[model samples]
Target: MAKKQSNYAYIGIAFSLLVFGIIFIPKIVDRVKVGDITRNESRSKKVLTNSDPVVADLMYLEINGVPKKVPPFSFVNQDGDVITNKDYEGKVYLVEFFFTTCGSICPRMNRNLVQIQNTFSDAEDFGVASFTINPEYDTQKVLKAYADNYRMTNPNWHLMTGDKEAIYALANIGFNIYAGENPNVEDGFEHSGNFALIDKNGFMRSRQDDFGNPKIFYKGIISEEEKEDEDGETQEISMLKADIAKLLKEDLVK
Candidate 1:
């Protein structure tokens, strides 16, 4: 009788542990999922609590006041040709700063940029530019390899690399985005993965945090407009296309 009781006690403890595992395992997994979503959302909003003030200030630039010119930059493309400001003249360029080996936000930003490229496929005036902050490591060959991995063979998408100081300076001062080498770490540079939209007139129109919300991703480009009645109000409501159309229409009037 005592022997039977001991066997039953052992069975009960094993059953209890099994039941607890079954109940808690999924909760742990769900918590991890929620944490990932929260992190991604924070990145998308560009709300890096740990980031420096210079980084935050650079992410949001004013549009109407003093005109901000994207300082001239010279970088080699994947094809090894020299690319400069003149290369993007009279075009709408979507600019993003990233390092190829970044494991966190770079892939998300690249995917969103690819979506934008597909959306504006027929628009010849639109282009995308990605600048690598880690110039020392991200040589033309490495950038070419990265571009090939993404299958980004489109002429409109340019992956550029130049001197490390020049790229970092452009990110901090010219583009108003924070980018620098990690002081404590070697090789890689830390940068916010925000996309900047530059209009044909050489104005920085919008800066989008790529990992934030899907709405922020498409907020940059100009969209086409359907003609309205004599009232002059817009008929179709495409915010991105409408903005672009408005800019183009204003240019035509000028």
Candidate 2:
């Protein structure tokens, strides 16, 4: 009787394995084929293809009925000034996470930001807050040199750095942007090439898509002139520029 029961148990285990193979093997193969199993890229980053229509009033990003607000933060900028969210209370700004030594996407992201900075050169209320993910290596002196290299002349464009844990929290938790270190990647770091738009009064803002969903963030990897990236993602820099202009015109709440 005991031998018979052991044989039955072995049979049951075999049957369960067969069922799992039939159900999950194909799905796993499909995901692998579609490049969804990548280790070098951020899974949280949304790819808003260029063809998506961008037409809607700038909407406040809300969660559970309350408008999302920029979380409080304090860091030293490239110029060695203590900057905080309060400094941008009445100003419209873009936020991004990048490291100075990044060779892949950081260059393109900063270049596009510089263009936007030039476009809004006259709007004193328009600004940019760039936080470094690798704060250990991106000191104030390093960020200052990088700012000069990129011609980031806008007085409001601050390349900031501080506590590594605090900066990571600001990127991953505070802003919901992806930025982390991974030794497997080329630069030993990975971050989303996306920018968050913040409106006056400290609320997060973005343009709605054709489907009436807030885009949430703009693609920072592609330039306005590029039309589309190599992966077929359309450049939203132009859209971003237009939206920034719109936000600049909004009246500050008293």
Candidate 3:
């Protein structure tokens, strides 16, 4: 009787151990799988950090192995002809928002854009487009004058103007920048002086501020201090120029 009791106790102990192992093993495996997934996601985020903040975010927005769609736009160019999204279907473009009478930073931005045009003059895939935030003031004639002032005669370079509301909507909502009437109403319409790089597929890949540096613009927060910087004269065009080159080079590889 005593031997039987001892045997039964041992059996019970073994069964308990087996049951515990069965319950805990799946949990352990699940934990390992979750850990692996977390590690891969972290690695991916790290890999996306590059010179262009917008491009860096684009890594997460890719669908079917390509960046997401770029919104369509319609505006009048320097020539007074209507330009639409269809015209830019197969071209990669550098886009900027500016006004002809912007005494602070518009000239510098145009100069930098001219430099970009010169850099990619031989590349048939690349072009430049500037949309006037003050469309009422920057009519086709005004944009034409502005383009000529910058010596921008490239058939591909388009200085554009359109309806006031349409231009404001594009600046604020489309490109995700600030553009509206100034509270003081003395400084004209307030809009970001940043250049956006759009790929051939029409995805906005990058944005660089007026200083021609990608580092100046953060995705979510555009600092008031940065706006002040745009108001000042600064010669830092090399950084933005390099970003354009990088984008072109990457496109070439694909």
Candidate 4:
């Protein structure tokens, strides 16, 4: 009877180690290989160019057939510092819009952003930024508290709040994420649930479909128009990271 109990204990220890390895091994291996993620993507080592067709409509204006560089933007970060496109020059960044009081998808979206931050927080060429739709409520002090809650102290990770119209304008015309307030909605607000990938030159990250063809994810979101998916957020964070990594590997750095 003692021998059987001892065997069970050993099996339990082995199961615990297996679970631990399953949970952490991939993240660790990914951190070690972070630099190589982009290189491992497409077979060609050729640098990305403006001429490359964008994967999303409404992300950029097309002069001919290529995605045009978005104009510079301005906002105030949690620390109350003004941030502009000039602030992100030569950096590959991810962007999103959320409100502090959101009780649903925003939390999950933030979790994904946190993962993105953790994955490449140390990469000089990479950064993450989020804009608050509720600027009136998400003051610098409120934003600071929210950032603290997330333990987001990296100088490169910016949680920003500014003029409500200004934030909405940038969301509508610049980043393509929708921002608006609707009384009918449970939270009296609506915004896109996407995490947009911006290239070093400020163009949204364009991607190809499974057959290596350009596929537009979305254009800018307008008021009274919202997209809902039964699958919730369909795009994978891994794919978004790979897109960012691909942009990092681009030759557009100044």
lDDT of each: 0.67, 0.90, 0.67, 0.72
Highest TM-score, which number? Answer: 2
Each candidate's TM vs. the true structure?
0.59, 0.77, 0.61, 0.67
What digit string (tens of lDDT, one per residue) describes model 1 on residues 103-180? 776876676566556766777777878999877778999999998888775686889998888888888888877788
Which RMSD values do the candidates have, in order? 22.6, 20.0, 10.3, 19.1
Write the residue-wise lDDT of candidate 2 on 1-254 in tens digits: 99999999999999999999999999989987787776425544334323343323788788888889999999999999999999998899999999999999999999999999999999999999999999999999999999999999999889999999999999988888999999999989999999999988888889888999788899999998889988899999998998898888777875
lDDT for predicted candidate 2 compared with the true structure: 0.90
For model 1, which pairs clash?
44-211, 44-212, 45-212, 222-244, 223-241
Q: Which stretches of candidate 1 lie over 4 Å from their true place?
A: 1-64, 183-187, 207-254
Please give, for residues 229-254, the per-residue lDDT of candidate 4 as tens digits: 45453446655666666777665644
Which candidate gets the maximum lDDT versus the true structure?
Answer: 2
lDDT of 3 at 202: 69
Residue-level lDDT tens digits of model 3 in 176-236: 6577777675456676666666666566665434565334222211222243344464443
- Higher-scoring candidate on TM-score, 1 or 3: 3
- The CA lDDT at 73 in model 4 is 72
Worst 10 residues of 3 by lDDT: 216-225
Candidate 3 stretches with Cα past 4 Å from truth are: 1-68, 183-186, 207-236, 249-254
User: Ranking under lDDT, best-scoring first?
Assistant: 2, 4, 3, 1
